[model samples]
Target chain A: MTALAESRRRPWILRRRTRRIVPVAILAAVFVFPFAVMLFTAFKTPGDVFSTPPALLPREWTLDNFAEAFDQIPFWRYLANTLFVSGMSVLGTIVSCPLVAYATAKVRWRGARPLLGAVLLTMMLPPQVTLIPVFLIWNGLGAVGTYLPLIVPAFLGTPFLIFMIRQFMVSVPDELIEAARIDGASEFRTYAQIVLPIARPAIVTAAVFQFVWSWTDFLNPLIYLGDPDQYTLSIGLYSFFGENDVAWGPLMAACVMFTLPAVAIFLVGQRFFIGGVSAGALK
Target chain B: MRMTTIRRRRALTGLAFAAPFLMGFAIFIAYPIGASAFYSFTDFNLFQSPDWVGLQNYERLAQDSSFWKALANTFVLTATGVPLSIGIGIAGAHLLNLPVRGQPLFRALVYLPTIVPVVVGGYLWRWMLNSQYGFINYFLGLLGITGPGWLVQPEWTKPAIVLMTLWTVGGTMIIYLAALKDVPGELYEAAEIDGAGPFSRFLHITWPTISPVTLFQVIVNVIAWLQIFTQPYLLAQTRLNNASSGPGESMLTYAMYLFQNAFSFLKMGYASAMAWILFLLTLAVTLVILIGSRRWVHDGAR
Candidate 1:
């Protein structure tokens, strides 16, 4: 086995491994030190934050910044709004993208290839190219300043998610779909029962991505959500930054809160996140 | 006749499956693209209907100093940022591929920054890059070196943005890491038998193996940098009352300027023109990269 071979070769490899530790440590520090600093700063008092020589560890750790962050803004309201938008977006993306992906990847029809090409073309098109006209259209419909502008597009099936899901669906064996068809399954029934179960991983990947994207999306919300009542966490954070530019403690605390859900999602879905990205790029 | 009915039924079913995306594409993508093109040639604001003004918006863009400045600034960022990011990604990937202890933890540490929202990352960097009482300068002082006021100084602003951008290179690094896994250990063993040093072995074996991934990363990063808005927008525009570009417009990227034109100035036509230009530039760059990739990318056949 390769394990036996590797073990025999381990003496030389083991020596080289020790040499690698220094660079690995440096890289880890470079990447992680800021988050550590942010965490420490969030716990620090305002005086401790602005001390002459900045402290890596807080002199007296406190929850005052978190309390202040809440009092300074409608933090809970923005969080609820963000959750609502992101939830709707994830639901829409999962429902719609896979249906379209099935059509393009498995359905036997003359239009399927051209439809796939259109999806790829749309993926390459910049959102800015369509930004003005889309805004105008939404404005004409009186959807501006509402969550409609933000959430409605997800139902339409994003090109990137469509492409990614289609890529996954293409590799699914035709015999399985054929078996379902031979059993007199309806096209929709087959898609829902057989294909959807098989493509669960891809759907989860797409959902996680959509959730993170919607959660962190600033520009669309910035353009559409003019009312404070409709503002998501991203725009809420931006507005908070606008008001308290020098209030680093509360700002850092708010940022930590803003980032926690995304970080938690990433940690939980780390496997799918890495797999989805590599699959997207490599395919 | 029976066979024809079945074929028609299949096509109908396909259309049913595709209907949602098709409807969205027609309304959101197709119509918007056509309308944006039409709007590009018109003088329109949200207040009134558009008046046809052929090529005037493009002509104004040609002469607009701020437009030119945004274009130049974006190019500067893209030109420097893309290569620096690719370099760091490759180096980090190699470091990660080393046989070591606790590799998963190290990988996670490097990748953790990427999952953080840009809004949070931008604000965090703004604080750390603060001229006084910030950690970056303080850390530098420990080594007896003075750090500049990163966000305040015009010359340092773009580089500071680039550095912050590099912090999220973990995404690209992961892609390269995936590519590294695909490289054969036998190739390395053969090279080692031939008395090749580690650097030479990398150049001969590893470089060729990952060139395809490098091409893909380059195009993706180029498009991203071309459309960069949030990092600079958040860093420079702290207050709602002041939306001006920071410190001599150094942080004013093309996308931010386009957003400003559309929203702030209400120059819908002008912004449309800028967007079309950006689209064309993205297409041109992507084409050049694809064409140039023929020389360097090893497509596995050769």
Candidate 2:
């Protein structure tokens, strides 16, 4: 009995057992294994890709696939176009969403309730519903095949972004806004000075989220941009797939190139992604 | 008197701040909705001005056998995909929320797929599901079982898309994890004291608490699924025959069909009609969900 008690009291044994570690490890492997294969394939030559056992490591490491992918798709141009559009959209969404969110969350007005309801309703509608209509309108304005159709929407506040920021805005103390008001600050001035500065975290969160969405968006670019010069990375990759005949090595290389911005952005701005995703749950 | 002036000025300022969005909505949104409805009444190819034919597009849509097939494929995908994704998300959240070491690492691993572009995800999944050289098939072969041609076979294509979607459940899991955090520990403790087992406690306590979130997720996911395009487009293009008919039209979603008509075939009028039908269907489904919210969504937590 004493020996059993002593064994139970040992430091390692005393630690709380998860009763789940093995299963969770298995689940984690399932989640991660495809990415492992993708990374491995990106290093190989096209000739080695369909080898019988599917190598986890290349016998001869080569950058040939990456070079081929680049040459085939005008990858650098697509990357530049994608960066310009997605970067601007992030900047524009961050700038505009807060203005609307401030109005809804901080101000009391006759139209506030109705306006807020409108934003929520907008979130409910799938963007696909508006695809053709929006296309025709842009086409009529001669904006089709240009970046304008893609960039223009960012200047207007998105309802989903507004919803996220407004929820964050609700937690900002009314005392701060009122105190600024008493200090000879106009409402706009208080928003600029006090509210905007404090809402930086949420703004960053919105920016990162918007960047990911815009960067990865295939349909909007697929529809709006007619010329190859204006194509973003998503469309570039699509054309890459079409040209490559599903060449696993070069395809994976191109995919890695396309996905780098988002992965880098996420890693850099992880705190915000976690925070913004959580904020959506409160309401 | 001074207060009245301040209030009036504030209202004007509000309007000024909101003006850009309003203008964009009017020009880009409202104009197109009305114009698309108008176009649906006509026969328009891009080169030619629309000729008003009045309900002809709708009649043509009814006669379009491919439209019905595409619609059926979409329904089958959403019906299976949404529930499977929700199940995976919830299970993942439950596991992540438990007190465990290396929690943040696990969270990051799960969230990684969401950051990859959909095009990349589709291609990667295609390789993983390949019949001959795919790792999945090889593993199955070791067990004396043969794996079917997943992306190539018409019967298996939609299920293949569904499988790919399951990889991104991390997005939904993040939301569920946040909601699960708000579930009170005391309720679990009480249930445990009453001799309720883990499964029983989950059904009685956890399910009730998370039901609203699940409902919200269902609506968002269903609406998103109804517009499925990227997976089908990629898979269809890569299918062996190089066919636009898309794997027995198994991969031909409603959006894909709209795309084909609008861009490929240049049947703008017909595509416009299809878009309107989709819009109305989405609006109606959303409205029904909103009306039914009180019946299922428990907002009393606030």
Candidate 3:
């Protein structure tokens, strides 16, 4: 009983008997393990990669895989294409999502409730429902092979992002908007000057998430981009794997490089990103 | 007259703000919904005009073995994956919620995998899941347990996907953590004063408090899993960019098969029919869960 009391008295970091830390450590390790494998494997020589009784860490690290991945796929070109698409999308979300969210959330109109309901319905509806027809629409417009299929959707407010930003905006006090309106500011002026500045963090959250989604998206790019030169890193890595099925080192290297920008952005916007996900659940 | 003018202007301005999404909904969502439903009833390949076939696509779907296999695969993954992910996420949140040093670091570590690109995640999972040289089997062998070929064997393929599904559960964990944090601390103190143990406190207080969140997460997971594509596609893919359906077609999830029909086989009508079927099935499952939640979920609305 004395020992139990003393154990409970100690700071948890110093106590071995603490229940939570052990499981947290184990799960954290499991989470980090695949990434460790990705990193270690990227630096390993091909011989070491396939050697019997495989080692977790490299016997000898090499830069061969990084060079090979570049040669195997036009890494920089795909990177530029992905950056362009994802960058444009981040801009797109920043412009459109907040404008719509402000109208639905702050502006009092009878259509607002119905519009919010429509937003929820669209958010819940499966993308597969519209997959083929949308593809045909793009195919008809002759936008199939270009960035239009990839980038154009971003200009349209994504339902999930719109919903999230609106949830954030709903908390903005009505008095603020009313005061602005009473002062002879038009609705657009009120939204832009009074609301948008206050909603900047939410917009930033929306923007970062949009960039990441476009960066990581595969299915749309797979269908839309016909030419090999046009491939984003998401599917470009696939062709890399196809050509170098046995070249695990290069594949792993390419994957690490492919993953870095998103990780960096996630870390930078980590606070906003976590907040955005939960806002959907709670609000 | 002046007041009415102001009201009309405000209404029109609101309409102007929402125009992009409304236009997007009509062009991207509304038109496709109508077009797909129409196409589902006819044999309309990409280049050709629709030829009415009544329920032929549905009939073919009814009789198609590949469709059944795909359906079975999807059902198995969704059934197993959704519960495990929610359980882990909630359980993980509980653990993370405990006062400990470097809590943020641990939380970030857990979440780091989620931000990894799916293409990257898929390939990395495949690499780790490799039969002989892969780290997963290597670690298993070190523990004196012979690991199965995760990607090669048909029986193991779905489990591999489930395991991969579990890997990126940090997203759900973060959401659950947020929900858990929203639970007032005084409730726990009051329960403790009543001499209720931790388990009982969680059972009576925490469980009911987070049930709505759990319900939401469960529905989201169900919807996502039923359409699981990129993971299995990358996992089961063969070289030269062919989307192999894994060993013995075990990896042919419903969405993948639909994609195959739409793009590979160019069976546009059949694919559209499959799409509607998937949509209805998702709706049914979601409805069931929502209905069932009435008994369990404690709505703590502010």
Candidate 4:
């Protein structure tokens, strides 16, 4: 950083900041490049999209793909279903995870320690291990075509989210909970009135993750939601494969639309989402 | 005694709070795991009751060439893909951590792909890797290098999956970046003053500090690759209800195969058996990583 060191650097490449920026720029650009293609392809004419020598921009930009995507599929219906599922999922996480975190992290009870351990252990299990049996349970109740298989699990509690919230709740000063009780607040009162307010960051992180998971989820919906009318945007967008020829422009446009909500949520809650990478919570 | 009554009341309060998850675990998780184990040993296909077949499904999985291929493909990804992702991710984090303007924005751009809906990511890659008109080949063409048939050739499909996997290595990068930020800068300065080279300085300081996160990422990445479904599943689709597994079944991933046996073939018992094998495989690999990395994964207390 010294002026003398800067002036006499053997090569411009030895200029440390310039050297660093080159690779970083290339890496970032590589990651962002696909997204740029997705956006540009969405606007390109079909001919431009598959141009023999591919070009980044369309010769004549158009909105025809977005229109086609809507016409080709039940775009609005699928979007509505995705939003409802994601929103209800966020609602479910907000209501359930923190309460569970409270009991396991704040309250003094013998079961608390073992329950936390159980949560961690369960978090490590592969989803496939339980995939078939869980589906059977839903199918047995004749809830396969409904949103119950997806939405109801969030209300119960997701082990990962519960574990995350618990890690945050563990650091809550014991004095705070003790003081809330000293004020004659009941256990539920202390949770709802005091601890819940303090747990906003963790709750927001949980909401961001839950909303994205439900919105983007394919496997459960693919298996359980047999009816086209019940399909979320994910399953709906995937229907492009069923057709003989993939409409590249429309597919790209639908991909863009499908990606936006998750990106928006991530942007809005960027801090909490990134901050939830606590070393303890992950392992 | 009043003390015992108060204790009982406190226990009840905690129980009320934890009830939802506990009941959820019992019915949804514990029950399914138990049921799956029982079903793994039987020949139940949901049309009728399970008939005990002892070790038949497990034995059949041994003879199942599809099972071996799926296992091999998954291992290739995990063995090659996970390490490459971790290596590139860590290296990328080091570069991103260099003193530069716009560091935060660069960091976020790297993570952007990780959050893109996986299905969207899959379909976009399918387009992007198209041999003729795909951007990848187009770029390669510009470089005067003929790119291989990325997703089309059976030999190339797994590499395509790995390529896609690397694009999202940013998730691993961010986690390592967080760990990197925790390393005391003074240690690096001290090492530099002692005339240590960059690699040695990194060897002594950075690796030791971030090894825990590395261990964590390794285990997590292994599990993810083992259960990779959506990418291969999406890529292999040619028509509705026509189960294809890419060129020569190259894309028949373990989870996908299990899904086919259970749902498509109506072989619930067979699928359940596959589940248990997957569980043991996961457990064994996880243990190997955990036990193997003990010397390297600093517990921080040291």
User: Which of the numbered candidates is closest to the native, going by highest DockQ?
Assistant: 3
lDDT by residue (tens digit), candidate 2, A183-215? 999878988999999888888888998999999
| All candidates: TM-score of chain A | 0.93, 0.91, 0.93, 0.93
Candidate that would win on lDDT = 1
In model 2, state the lDDT of residue B216: 82
Per-residue lDDT value at B152 in model 2 = 77
Instruction: Give the total clashing residue pairs for model 1.
Output: 0
**Residues A1-283, model 3: lDDT tens digits:** 9777776687673555356578888878999999998999999998889987878789998999999999988999999999999999888888899988987998777678888988898998899999999999998998999999787777889998999899888888999988998998877898889888888888989988998999999888888888989889998887655444567899899999989999999999998988888887777
Task: Evaluate fnat for each of the predicted models and list the values in order.
Answer: 0.77, 0.56, 0.80, 0.71
Question: Which ranges of candidate 2 are over 4 A from the true structure?
Answer: A1-19, A242-244, B1-4, B238-243, B287-302
**Residues A45-123 of candidate 4: C-alpha lDDT, one tens digit per residue:** 9889878889998999899999999999999999999999889988988998898898899888888999898888889
Q: Which ranges in model 1 have alpha carbons more than 4 Å from their true place? A: A1-16, A242-245, B241-243
- The residue-by-residue lDDT of candidate 4 on B18-112, one tens digit each, is 88788889878899999999999999888898899999999999999999998888888778888898899889989888878898889889888
Question: How well is each residue in B188-261 modelled by candidate 2, as lDDT tens digits?
Answer: 99999999999999898888898888888888888888898887776666531122655677789988888888
Full ranking by lDDT: 1, 3, 4, 2
Model 3: per-residue Cα lDDT over B240-284, one tens digit each: 245579999999999999988999888999999999999999999
DockQ in order = 0.71, 0.54, 0.72, 0.70
Report, for every candidate in turn, its global Cα lDDT versus the true structure: 0.90, 0.81, 0.89, 0.87
Docking class of 1: medium
Q: In candidate 3, how many Å is residue B106 off? A: 0.9
